[model samples]
Target chain A: MGNRVIKMSTLYLTEQGSILHKTQRRLVIIKNKKIIQEIPIFKIDRILIFGNIQISTQALSFILDSGIICSFFSSQGKFKGSLRPVESGNVFLRIAQYERYLDKEFRVEISKTIVYAKINNEIKFLENYSKTNFKEIIEELKKNINNLKDKNSISSIMGIEGHSTSLYFKGLSLILKNKFLFEKREYHPPKDPANALLSFGYSLITNEIFSLLSGIGFDPYIGFFHELTYNRPSLALDIVEEFRTPVVDKMIVTLINKNIIKEEDFQREENSIYLNNIAKKAFLTHYEKRIQNYREIIKVQCHKLMDSVLNKKIYEPYLED
Target chain B: MGNRVIKMSTLYLTEQGSILHKTQRRLVIIKNKKIIQEIPIFKIDRILIFGNIQISTQALSFILDSGIICSFFSSQGKFKGSLRPVESGNVFLRIAQYERYLDKEFRVEISKTIVYAKINNEIKFLENYSKTNFKEIIEELKKNINNLKDKNSISSIMGIEGHSTSLYFKGLSLILKNKFLFEKREYHPPKDPANALLSFGYSLITNEIFSLLSGIGFDPYIGFFHELTYNRPSLALDIVEEFRTPVVDKMIVTLINKNIIKEEDFQREENSIYLNNIAKKAFLTHYEKRIQNYREIIKVQCHKLMDSVLNKKIYEPYLED
Candidate 1:
């Protein structure tokens, strides 16, 4: 199953009032009774529907029957929910996962591997992009990575991870060419344009990992690093930490430094900053490209996690070069 | 949360060539270019759409947004799948559930309690309606009920439960007024009319419990007595054991004995017997009535399970008086 490679295409329905209709094997997007786009449904792998788009029940059923995942998001790209096929029928893997989650030593071992890889990736990213300007901060992050060996509890590892992330983001703030004021990492409605871009990129990557994990038959709610939180996909969160610096943070830094996205491109509403439509299109294009390059790595990481859970293999986190 | 009672209504779209449309706050069902039914959307608690029914994307979104579960079924009432809102935000409860599932002693304790109540309810049902004709079977079931106390493992308890159920069904066969021949329990396409009714009723009740458990934030895929099976909601299956005799089994007995569902009302296709449309309607009506009466008991049992998980309280199953 892991070796089989399939070309995947994602259809995004971002138009507010467009309706999705089905015609035989094709999906037609219509806005105000005007045909805007048509694609063969077989060629599409998944769909991301943004705010207020209507779909005909036939099309909805067809998508579901075809086992295509459809995710719903607010116009601002806040993930509302998703509709996926019945989860993979692999209860034994989940049982193995539950057993591992119950074992404190196993949880600590896996959590440390994840946190170590995350900080390593952060240091690599910093060295590649902003080494001269942020040398002390980068060395501080490297020290924290080494310090992870002595951390015996998940919360203590989290404490080191939190401090390292703050330093990494502070280093990132220095690398911006567009004078984007990013003092610290703020989210749940990111405050600054840099933070907003980071948050959006993280969301996209997190959703990708979430779908991948579900398809691989792991209970995405259970995790080793992230403590259990209500409605939070903790396992997905744990996996995404490894990808954060390599995927989202790197792309976000490039987007800001290359002037591909400007400060004015983001709009502020009620103390939250988000990319406007045009900027979102630019960001998504780059985001998709970066994700396409890393898709295999993400899949491999997931399979490794499965190996750790099921075969009791020592969990190894993905380290960026 | 359990104490808040709300009126619920289910809309079943069984017609093969119908379309569902949304207008403002109402849902209109159209067939053959005519409006067949129009219902206020707010009045619907859930929807069950049978084969080939088309629902507008607008209506589907409205249903999802309203937090109403929509389940799909085959024309012959086979359980297909469902669309539900984002699951409740309660990860702590799930963690507690996982911890309990991982404890061998707790698993056995809960499993024994569930199986014991299930058999006791079966005995009560048999004694209520078929006491004189099947006295030996009832006595045998009674003996197995006592045997449950000595059962130390979930599989052993399941052994007793399975034997008692077979004996209970044998007793049920003798009491049928109509010439419905149900020699044993058969499923995955019930082979006879009696098994068809039983399977259909169980499917409905199981779906109800599945939704109930999900709404209450339990991972319905995990279980105690029922070993985890691929793609199976083992937890829901465990809870439904207690309801089988009191709800579905009793309804099937009444439907068969009262001659409400004649043998002629069932149609055989390939190797499976299924209720025809009219008979399905009659059976569903009675099934809904029976479910309405036991709804509170089922909810209470779920809450008790929650208490057992969260508080480590003694888990008790609901037994018929």
Candidate 2:
């Protein structure tokens, strides 16, 4: 109808955050003793909470009812966790998802596709930002990919991934802007702002894929590229590898090059750089926009993964051209 | 990876269809006693069988392995059935889907949104194609929509939908190209080419939603607008209401106006008309293109429905401006 309105994609909560509560059949955000924003529950898709955001029981229930995905990140842009709706009701998709992991040949084949896509995209990214020839990294990546043809063991596939990623990161170091320093890829408590942004960005994408896979009734804890762990969403991590370069790495480079995020937005603490609240907000905004731009591609990739699991078809990771 | 290739969306099989089988790790399609096409298992998403299509067990297993959806239709373009992979593994999404139906207020609220969007888009479509004033139809639609505000009974809502849809078909009849006759919408056997296309197009959209809902772990049988019936995917039918006019109706009008489909393309059988093989292919091609065009919108609407079921948020149907 003419009176209809477009729904907002992600709701970013910040600035001492706010206490979200139900008011007059609508969800309202209150901050600094003032009402900030009130939206009809239906208008929101995801809630991106940065820092200590408070929520009332009614609001949480409404969120559950709305099936909105809520993502929590620390003040330093570290991913805490997410509160999403329950898994899909279809039990068979999980059975198929689980069944695929039992096939060693299938696991190795798919893992090769994921890691190859990741390394290749990394080579492409570094080539775009740096004048340095990534010939060596590219050569090594190609060799390992060729070796994947003869490899049918998960451990061998993982070894190739680990070795190739180090070379990819070494090339990544050559592309950073002068003020931003990148030595190696680090996950917990990143040593520099770039690493911090990269880690946070990776978490954002991982959460997204996790929700998608879980929503589709896949066991995210079991994966091919990444080994199964007690608590980690290994499958999401496996898929995350392909996207890390084009989605996260690209965002980090653009943020630094364009001066969207700066050293002032990060705080130094015990050999680690933490993104301040303001920087976190900026990052969240950009992260959401980036996701929106690639929403179609991401959705298609998810379906492709589903197809692979159900049909034992090849699972090719996302490769940015 | 460089070796990876994009998968095709739909594979249409015609003319005593084909004997599909696996040969040396590839799925091959044989028609008229000759091999016509051979594609890797991963390259296909769905197989559209228009006539007497034959499949070997090995081929069926290969299709299942490829996770390829198989949709069967009569020569007249009537939907027979579809074979898709098992539903999503998550049991909770379906639980929420079923729970929502128990809440009368929720059912009534969502039904209103769906019917309103359907009527509104129908009015828009007819107005675009008809030179005649649609004031009466528009007024009737508005009256029923306003009446929907006070009505909560499922029967009452369904009554409104039926009445509104009749008026909509009446408006549709006024907009068809001169040679194309559309007296009334007949589903079991479409009375005219227009009606045949309409039924076939609706079937395509319904199946798409069914697969998506199943993938999201919602029981396609449970719904808000349409009443549940044995062997009927009522929920998919309910959601299909909002999409019928905008996606299917608009495409039908466009196909006629552009001369993509002509009266000669159909054969009269007693009182009904059936699309010839060539016409069916044209329609399928256009159908696929149209689906691709609205793919993003359809995906968003499904997510919105999921949001509504899970979060108690108002489910807003897609409204074209």
Candidate 3:
């Protein structure tokens, strides 16, 4: 849909940062950059620090003053604390908003958030699917994609596609290593050892999707169908669909194959699964490195994609089975 | 967190002029605030509209001159394209960096991100949980929270006494109406209609979380436990957990009990239930308005609780059965 810029291979920073998402921007400060100690860029929204980073009150004050999000982590990549800006620092408002959503307007807003998110996501996915396997998938559009093209309306196209895509997502377990399957649908508090991994992984993957969408400057929550309830990041889910296979599932496979994460990393008791501290620590190492190592592809000389999308460059998303 | 200032909500207008997203700054926009174009800022990344809320050639040239991210979104909130200022647009370089993560160098960096995000989100959630229920949920911590003279390690005391807090979240379904049975570890492709509601509702709630997290300057993607992966937003989930029950679930009960929504809205097919388009749209309209509606409370001002937290003010969270 836009100009194409693909960064095929690059080294990602092993450290991590917070997910500063917005309708128009994603602000991320590399821990390695130590921007916190440097002159404050009050414009940057999220500052992510990892691997034994230290900070001063001045930096913290700057973050607060600028209303930037400052998330911290240990050298081992454990999440530490957040320095939320003032006014936004009110956690009680979050609770009250939560209360209101539950009491006054749950279904109307919550459902719409999900619905719109489904539509936005499915539409993007189908368009990509169409371009990627244009010949093959398009042929099955009538059945697998619920005949989306046949619909004269965009809403109909999105609705039909959303249902079909979800079905595909639900069936992903069959293709994945069963140990990695939390089935979310089948989770009885997960009598299996991988339950915690799945839960954590899904949540992780969803957030990553949110960051990417925001970085690309899309609304992370103003979804079409998903209700716009207080503090819900529907936009994150809206974009996560296409990447789940590549970011979460593929990483799971790689983690398992490399012994970066083991069955022992997960614990099961009475049908519920949890990640032991050690297992979590081990898995976290590999996961952190993977994202920092991630890089996008781009044309050698073209801001053309970024500057003028009038020519319409195609971007095929990364998909991993 | 810091002090919050009250500002009137402004209607968003994209493509009116140059848009700026300063790093480390929370969601505050230093817009020329004089412009007014009702272009919903839903998915737009600070649209610098020199002409027709669009990235015309002149605008692209200016962005290229400035070396900023010129992000674009469709009016319907779809992410359309981006423009990197040539003066500073090294998107090609950024892509090269992304590709490096594909190499072995990526493993360690990626894994670290996952570990830290997990810790951060867990801590944030726990901190919130302890703040309100520390005394009641865990009697041992009561002395520290309730007693102003207790200069002891509030977190440590809460940690030891707040053991049952986990049961509160994990076992919430037990307290709800039988219409929604959150059984022991149910896998969440979420088969039950209630489960579907839970999933969808949680997503919306998380968006609200994103708004606050971003407004406060936290990177939604550089999460602690959630892996940094292409196309995922780990930070969004981290923020979502803080309000799941208080917002989405509560709203769900209200909808069902108040008869605002009916069984007819949900269509059960092949054992899976979904909301029809009409129902879904109706839900979003209401949800948006609800989010727009704000309440006043002690220690909390106009914005929701999440904002208060970001602003760094002391506020308490409340829960409803």
Q: Pick the candidate with the highest TM-score.
A: 1
Per-residue C-alpha lDDT of model 1 across residues B1-321, encoded as one tens digit per residue: 112113446677887788888889988999998988888877777788777788766776677778887887767776556676665757678778888888889999998888888888888887776357678887898899888888888888889988988898888777766468788899997888888888988888888888788778887889887888888989999999999988998888889888898989988889998788888878877877778789888889999999999999998889889
TM value for model 1: 0.89
Q: What DockQ does each listed candidate score?
A: 0.45, 0.01, 0.01
**C-alpha RMSD between model 3 and the true structure:** 27.7
Question: Across residues A45-125, which tens digit of lDDT does each residue of candidate 2 receive?
Answer: 677666656665456545655667666655555555454443254445554665676677788788878877877787677
The estimated TM-scores of all candidates read: 0.89, 0.48, 0.32
Question: Model 3 segments beyond 4 Å from truth?
Answer: A1-59, A62-68, A72-142, A152-171, A178-195, A208-219, A225-227, A257-259, A268-272, A293-321, B1-321
lDDT of 3 by residue, B33-58 (tens): 53222222222332221112322222
Candidate 3 DockQ, CA atoms: 0.01
**Deviation (Å) of B80 in candidate 1:** 3.3
Interface RMSD of 2: 21.1
